[model samples]
Target: MDLSFDCIVAGSGHAGSCAALSAIDAGCKRVLVIEKGPPEWVGGNGYFTAGAHRTVHGGLQDLLPIVRNATAEVASTTDMDPYSAEEFTADIMRLGNNQSDPTIVRAVVDGSRDAIGWLAERVHIPFIFSFHRQAYLVNGRHKFWGGMVLSVEDGGKGLIAAHQQALEKAGVTVWYDTPAVELKLDHGHISGVVVIRNGERLQLSAPAVVLACGGFESSVDLRAKYLGSDWERAKVRGTPYNTGDGLSLAHSIGGQLAGDFAHCHSTCWDANAPADRGDRVLSNQFTKSGYPLGLMLNTQGRRFVDEGQDFRNYTYAKFGREILRQPGGYAFQVWDARASGWLRMEEYGDDVVDKVSAASVTELAEKLQAKGLEDADAFIETVAAYNRTVTAFDEEHPSVKWDPAVKDGLSTQSTRESLKLPKSNWALPLDKPPFLAVKVACGITFTFGGLAIDPDTAAVISEKTGQAIPGLFCAGELVGGVFYGNYPGGSGLTAGAVFGRKAGRGAARVMRS
Candidate 1:
């Protein structure tokens, strides 16, 4: 059967929901949103995100000034204090290494504030300001909620429910468990989407189609192809349904991909560990123990990348690149009691500390003996040195330059003060008994690369000539390079609102014309 809609949005994640709602609100007579999985399962990398929503204008206008102001405010709240738009742009450019699309970057940054504000106005959704609350502390109950659409339940369920309510209110039709199998193109323009529902193919025509179906974190072949062998071989900890459906369909329609080489949250929890109980962990846990968070070391026990370096300055991809140079493509985080104590302080609510302490460092080494670094003594020495260096650093550099956007600085400072440690102690020495060590392997949550799009209109762009792909739009993970290298505080959800609205409104306009 032939069906038509003013706009068609694939995926019901944050981005898809926002886009559909925006389009219908913009006066589209008919809008249809298709999800490959059930709404309850409409989760990808976004579910695991820290929920940072950075905007400049505070939901005033879709422009760059608002983004700069919002960034400044977020920085101020985090104690970094008063960053400029130019600085924010510089950070983005430096982070992305100048490979991002300038136009898209400008649009995303400029429109951030308004997008966040728009989401905050929703009656059912509650938006929390992350920076206003001080940095994330180890055991402190810190929940990040800025410009995010959260439900009353305070989990993925809440976010999905909020979006569903908004979409329904705006007169948008949602098709759950309906996977878009193909894109229909006519005369070099996207005309419709072919969806698979209950084993039957249904062709739904639209004037324009928006692909917000997220990335391929769960797809091994796509991960291997776009990311690296490590990602290809590693286990996934993000959404299961994010099988690169949008990428495949877009590629079939001649859409070009960008940032295919990027992925985020390089370190993940060891699902294989019996104690882990199939939960994910980050490599930064090593840093919590006063060891190098993402430093590089060889099988023979050596230092790489100044183990004391900050995680914000580098991406997980960089860490993965470093770890791959070591023997067996794996590394260990070594630390004694003092280091474990500090880690325990920081990881207050998290279960990492408990798991690390359940067994001795020697026993832990034996557990990961097959992974490499079988010498427990060498690991112990490494922990000792790490503790000494951390203690020394605390004495020398009393002031910690904690970036609030990523973590809770106030809690960190409070923890340090309570311990009677010097203010500059960036490193907490690991000195206590029963030293702990754990083998860490890289894991990816989502691919950073996908169809290139115009930030202003959320329209896909061709890589060959840098022109907008007519009648096609995209948002969320499908839009590459929007986050540059380091993801800003809340850009994921903000992008869903900003670009989702733009794509929806743009598609509706096209339908009317």
Candidate 2:
């Protein structure tokens, strides 16, 4: 097979696939995708995702086309509020504590809707409302309030397969089990790449190269070195292949690292999940994020963080670090029957394990004890105190109002007298029958830090020279300066698609020149 190409995309995740598609769409005939893993793991971390894609849109009208199965009755009742570019930009910047690059954030925000539309219309990828993650039923109507309203038809793996099929149909070649080892520089510009395939090292020359591989989340050495001392203990949430090859290659050629290297997109994952990538059958089901509706207790049966401080999208990323800091690098999410109903169905599939349930809180505590928890009395007392001190409510002001976005329910009104951390909202008395608990541990999704890139062209920028390398481009988790302490849910895929398209076009333009 010919190794030479006009453009080479490292990795075959959402970003790399989009980059390859855009390059071919831009008339670059020779486009090849070099994937480090085999075909089963071709999607990288993107394959494990729920396929949520955040984008700016003008309410339900703008959403109708992409949500292909919307019935007339559903369309009439479902409410999808307008999410503007300004709102998207503000949310990203504010969540990053103003640490994100304004220009890159602006570009991503402005192009998100177009990116989604392009994938749906041009690439023939189907989209639908994200019923599991973003929608809520209220007063006989379903309201989708978060900017994350749409996702590809069959979640992340399906989405990746769909795009890969589309690219293959267009005659783009994807080399599996081939990893790019080094960037070959020609006169200070990236001219080619050195790759390892089947025990042989081959140098593939391309006029332009796009690095959409991933970050260092899967590398224990890199995680401990950059993310903190104990970060090596965090569970890996996706594919083990994202060991920061692109970032290291870029750094060797003077690319500046951007964002806080110590921060990552972490979450509350199942304690019994595999140390590396989770099971493909369960996919993202290893996550247990319904903490807002219940209590997260440390080993000693004490609430550590306020469960209802914000929406799950705003708080889930950073909470895994806290969970890791607890004793034994784990915790338990306890909920009653009411909250159990609200638990995502994905988390309770046939493949799930490590859940404990009982008819009473005391019995639940005993069941938890058998699962290695120490004290049942302490847990009983904690629930008793929580229920006793919960804020009073009457028929007029109910405990929960079913708001789709933000904290919209009863909270422990003044834990002012208690030393324990309080539940800020959606704090119902855990007195219902059939109490349940799930063991949880820290799962590191992706590292937030990576190589900085030029906003306009997605070109890799040199920290030393403050100039973009002529033929290098990047997207996906390899591009930094977009996130810091936290990330809004569904934005990662959107950012990937947006910048991937830009990087593809930029590389194609370079190759054409």
Candidate 3:
């Protein structure tokens, strides 16, 4: 069999799929994608995502032509606000504490819409309006919030299926159970790669290799080393194949390590989920991101972080880290009957999670005590104090209607009985029973640290020479400095596509040169 190829991409995930297609688009005839997992394990972390994509657009009308889920009747009832390039950029910079690399941020933000467009047109991704996740019906109209509105029809599984169809159509060959173990460097330039296939190591010759495998989030040792001791206990939220293979292959060849090594994108996941792998059928369903509509309490039954600190898109990524720091590496989300209805059924459906509920706060505390709540009395007192603050605020602003579609400032801080750590938005009195709660643990999505790359070309940057390595390119979670402490909800998929396209084109150009 012929092993000769112009460009060989590592990892058969969304980023690698985009890179393979883009390489073909850039006039490269022979391209190969190497997959680390068996034939069953494809799409890497992308297979476990919600398929949300955040891009700049002129609200609903601009997106109507691209999405299949929107109809005349749905558009009439939908109220979507325009999201601008500036707003997207500010979100990353602000969430990253202004420490994110400007060039990387600009590349992902500016290229998002076009990358998504390419995925839709060339890859035939079935785009949808994401009404279930991003919008809530207020009065009559479905109002969109958090600046993310586009997704695929059936989430990540659909995304990967579409990519597989496109790859077959494009004549891009994919080798399953083949993991790129090392980058072959000749005279300070990447020559090809050495990979393990079917229990044997083989060397493949190619001028260009695109590394889009993933980060070190799945490695228990690496998680303890970089993200801290508490993080070692965090649950893996994606493919178990992403064990920092791409990052290792690049860094072994002097690739610069940048971004927040101590930080990552995590969220409140179901406490009962598997420790090291995600459920293939359930996918991203274990993600408990409904805290923005309720409250989070530690084992002591006290509020830790402000649940309404920002939009769930902006805050959910880092909130998992907060949960890890809690006692026993878990927390409980408290919600009343009113706000519980607002939580997505995909995540909080009766069959999806094992939730504990009671008719009163006292009874709820008693139920939670069996689930490992140390101080049931403290939990009861906490709820009482929070209710008092919300009641006080509601009395002062009686005309204010509680709307979940926006940051309806029904705050607890404005009241005289406000707790020190206030629920700054969507502060509703948890008076109505039955009160409900779900046990959650930190679910790590990906690490924030990895190989640095040139923003323009997606070529991996050398630490020694401060220049792009001749034949080495990377995208997806392997390209560091695009995110820091946290990230916006839908931006990860968009970033992967943006840099994937650049990496593929760069690899093709490297071969041609």
Candidate 4:
């Protein structure tokens, strides 16, 4: 086989796959994909997601084909609000504290819907509404809020499989278990890539190379160096192979480092979850969100953060860092039967290692005490105080238009509840029987720090020269300046697809030139 190619893509995640597919579609004579991970775990961080993608759509009418089981009955009862490109961009920028690169943010927002539609139409990837995560039942109707409503049928794992099939159908060759060791730059121009496969080192020449090998989230040393000292102990939420290879590779050639190094995408995961990569079978099952419906207590049994500050999609990523700040680097999500019903089904699954249930608050406190809770009595008192200060639940009131999807926060009886830290939304008194608690720890998803790229062409930009490095492109989490302090769920995948496709086309054009 010829070892030379027009374009080479590193990594086999959603970004790399899309890069390869677009290159092949763009009429590249030979496009090669180098994946360091084993074939079974080739999708990088995207393999563990629920496959949610934030995109602009014209309400239910525009989503009917993409969302599975979109019958008239379901459409009438479900509120799939229109999401505009402006709204999507605003959400990302607002959540990132307006620090995100506007050009990249605009690119992501503009291409998001088109990317999803392309996957549905060209790649034959089936999508469905993430009813469980983005929907709430209000007055016998299911209302969907947030810009993220569409998801792949079988989550991230399935999305990877679909991409693999699409790549195969497109005649793209993927070299699995092959890690790119070095980039061969000739006269500061595009040249070739050095890779090792099965203990054999080989150099393959390519006019252009696209780096989509993900972030340094899985590297303990890198985490401590960039994310903070406490991040070394945080659980990795995705593939362990995603060290700093992509960042290092790009940096070695004068690529600019950008974005918030101290911040990352994180969540509250099970305390006993593997310190390395999460379980593929359970996937994101260990994540324990929905704290707005209940309360999160530290080892000392105190509410440190406002549980109902905002929707879980907006707050889940940053809250994991808060859990790490606790005494034991963990916390517990406590809920009663009433609130339990509103919790995501995964919280009640068997994969949760530290789940405990009790018929009464005292009994629940005893169970928590057994698990090393510092003060069981204080926990009970905290719950009592919360209950006394909470607004009365009256969803059936004739004068009330209580819709969680549209409501600002959880309703209070008269908006005059007195408390130190109040539950801003979805506050219900924990007066029901069969109380439950799940012990949780911090799970770091992906690092926000990465290589800077040209916003329009997805070309890697050199900090030293302040110009694009010829024949080098980038996409996925490895491309920085997109996220900062926080992230809106489902935007990562969209950005990956958007930028990945652009990188492929750009690389192909470079090769042709």
Candidate 5:
């Protein structure tokens, strides 16, 4: 069977959704989005995110002015100190170990802010301003899954329900549960896609195709092959459907892949442990009480890293690899009453005390049965040693500072000012009593590496010559080399918007030409 449209977008995650919407906005009369799985409530990882976004124009100077100017209305001041383009680029280069494509990185940074603004105007996505000065910060207040949610919002069905009221009103055709199985290429140009609908396969012809399928985080075999042995053992916290369909599709068509070697964010605790599957208790407790404070110790009971650093930094992957050397890649986080008090407030809140009880250090250790350490005495001793070291350092150093700005430092300033323990008190010690310990397992949200694309328009590029694959484009995690190593707070969503728009607009241009 065969069908034809102006454009066909594969996958229904944030990137695909944005590509469809942007295509429609760019004046494409016929656009069809293909999603493989059933529509789900959570809507993939976008719903689980803390929702931060950024942009620092470095190499894409020609387009920087357009994006910067377009994003002016939604740009918010941040308390988090900003890194200059050079600093940002340097940080990315260092993180990527110089493996990333400089042109792709520049395009992402240059188009970021404007993409946020575009999504807000098009979908009524709400954003909050950050108090930090150095960084670009914004709040995503769209209902459940809007804004970034629009990209993969159940494969654009949700967007079709709300904002796409305008699209339908404007005559956009959407096909549900249609999975793109093959790319229809003719004479080195993408002509369409072969899709399976209701188990019936059909060819959907189009002038251009956008492969917006998500990354390969869900495929354990692929994770082992591309990510390494460590990712093979890592727990996944996001969608199980993102199995690199886009990457596979692009590769089959001779599209180049980039950033296939980097990862962002690390899990200190696997809240998805089988024993705790249905219980939000673990997450609730940790987020409120802050049980994972102070120095984190592996099974052998020794400090491995500075516990205060943001977990999002891929550096945690190094710690994860180290901990996996233990019995099960598991570790214990020890803290006292004061730390517990803060953890309760920060992680679980006061109400969790009623659910899980441990009045003393020994009792807490007994409850958790922490590996390596025998009982609460061992846990208490570790806490004492940590406190002693903290005190000695405090007296000797007098002042503590982070080289680059810390995100969310300002919103948390009131808590810091009240503690009066120094700026590094953000790096607080576990000095108090009746301590707590919880076993943490490392988990990954999604893989960062994917297909390489043209930095100028996000069109999929050939691996041989680094030239664009005509009639093909990509965005979000499916297109790599954009996010160096560490993902700027909200780049995932922002990237989808920015590159999705560019890919859509560029595809429209190809069709018109």
Candidate 6:
């Protein structure tokens, strides 16, 4: 096999795919992609994602041309509000607690719209309106609640297939089960990568190396060391291959680390999910993000978080951390017939979770007790208190209407007769018969900390000199400082494409210069 290449990309996931394709577009004839897993485990975490891509668009009209599901009839029924650049940036800054790296965030925001267009036109990703996940049919219209909208037709699997088609058409080569073990440096510049190819340690020559390998969320030891004491036990929501190989390779060559090492983009996952890996058939269906329309009770049988604090898109990522903090590292989401019908079937379907249901709230608590709930009486009392509070609030504001498509001020927060905890939006009494409940646990998506890089060029920065490391580029979950505490939903995929494209162009520039 030829060991020489103009550019080498580590990991064949979404970010690496974009990097490789961008390099080819930038006139690089010899571009290689290396994967740590076998051909069956091809796309890494990108294969397990929802394939949601958050970007700026001029509402339904601007996105109509790109999305396959947006027919004329569908467009008439869809009421999607335009998402602006400012709104997108504000979301990240706000959710991340204003700690996102400004330069990196700005570049991703500025490049987001174009990246979406490229994914549709160049990569041929079958984009569709995220109707099931982000929209609710209200008043005979599909009203999109959050700023996020588009997703791949069949989610991440489809996204990977699309990238593979693009890569094959571009004549790019991908090597499976060939993990990049180390980086070779020559005169303070990146030379190539050392890889365990065919059980032999081989050194491949390249002027530019793009590291899109992902985070340390897979390594139990690394998870405990970086994310905290409890993170080692957090359920792995994606690929087991993201064991921080690229992080180690970059660290060996003085790559600086930035972002939150103690935090990650986690979510409320299925309590029965496997501890260390994701189910290939289930994928992101394990996510239980329907808490906004209901209440979550810990073992103590009391509401822990404001379930309706914000749109699920803004709050779902960090809520997993809260779940891990609860007693026995678990919680139960309770909903009645009034709100249970709103939960997405993909996530809460009978086939997806062990659904526990009862004809009344008291019986629901008893059924939940058999499924590991601690205080059945407390669960019942919690329901009674919540219903009473909602009833009182309704009496005060009789004209208020409960709408799921927006933060319609229907809430449990009141100066009088309110519980200690509040449901900030979409609050309705759990008096409707046939209550339902599901056990949930923390699912770690990706670690937030990673290599520091130049926002403009996607070039890795050195810890030694605090300057850009020549021929070294980073993107995807392995590129940090774009997020801190929490992240806006769908921003991760968008940032990957933006920085991946930038890294690809930057890689080609290294050869020319």
Instruction: List the candidate 5 regions with Cα displacement exceeding 4 Å.
Output: 56-91, 130-172, 262-265, 273-293, 309-326, 340-360, 370-380, 398-425
C-alpha lDDT values of all predictions: 0.58, 0.85, 0.91, 0.86, 0.57, 0.93
**lDDT winner, 1 or 4:** 4
* Residue range 237-299, candidate 5, lDDT tens digits: 455667778887888989987774556444454333432111222321222113224446665
The worst-scoring run of ten residues by lDDT in candidate 2 lies at: 391-400
lDDT score, candidate 6: 0.93
Give the least accurate 10-residue stretch of model 1, judged by summed lDDT: 275-284
Q: Which parts of model 3 are misplaced by more than 4 Å? A: none
The TM-score values for the models, in the order shown, are 0.76, 0.96, 0.99, 0.96, 0.76, 0.99
lDDT of 1 by residue, 257-317 (tens): 8763555534423423222111323322222222332223345555454444433333333
What total of clashing residue pairs does each candidate reach? Answer: 32, 0, 0, 2, 31, 0
lDDT of 1: 0.58
- In model 4, where do residues sit more than 4 Å from their true spots? 351-353, 391-403, 411-417
Give RMSD to native, each candidate. 7.3, 1.9, 1.0, 2.1, 7.8, 0.9
Model 2 ranges with Cα > 4 A deviation: 391-406, 415-420
RMSD of 5: 7.8
What is candidate 3's lDDT per residue for 1-513, written digit by digit as tens? 787789999988899999999999998999999998987889999999999999988888988988998889999999999999999999999999999999999999899889988998999999999988988988899899999999998899999999999999999999999989888988887888999988898888889999999999999999988878787789999999889888778888898888889899999999999999999998899999999888999999999999988889999999999999999999999999988988899999999999999999899999999898999999999988999899988888888778788888888865466789989889998888888999999999989897888999999899999999999999999889989899988999999999999989998898899
RMSD of 6: 0.9
Residue range 1-513, candidate 6, lDDT tens digits = 789999999999999999999999998999999999999888889999999999998888899899898778888898989999999999999988899898899999999999999999999999999998999998899999789999998899999999999999999999999999989999989999999988899999999999999999999999999877888789999999999898899999999998888899999999999999898899999999999999999987888999999999999999999999998899999898989989999999999998898999888887888878889889889888988888889999989999998998888867678988888788999889888899999999999999999999999999999999999999999998998889989999999999999999999999888
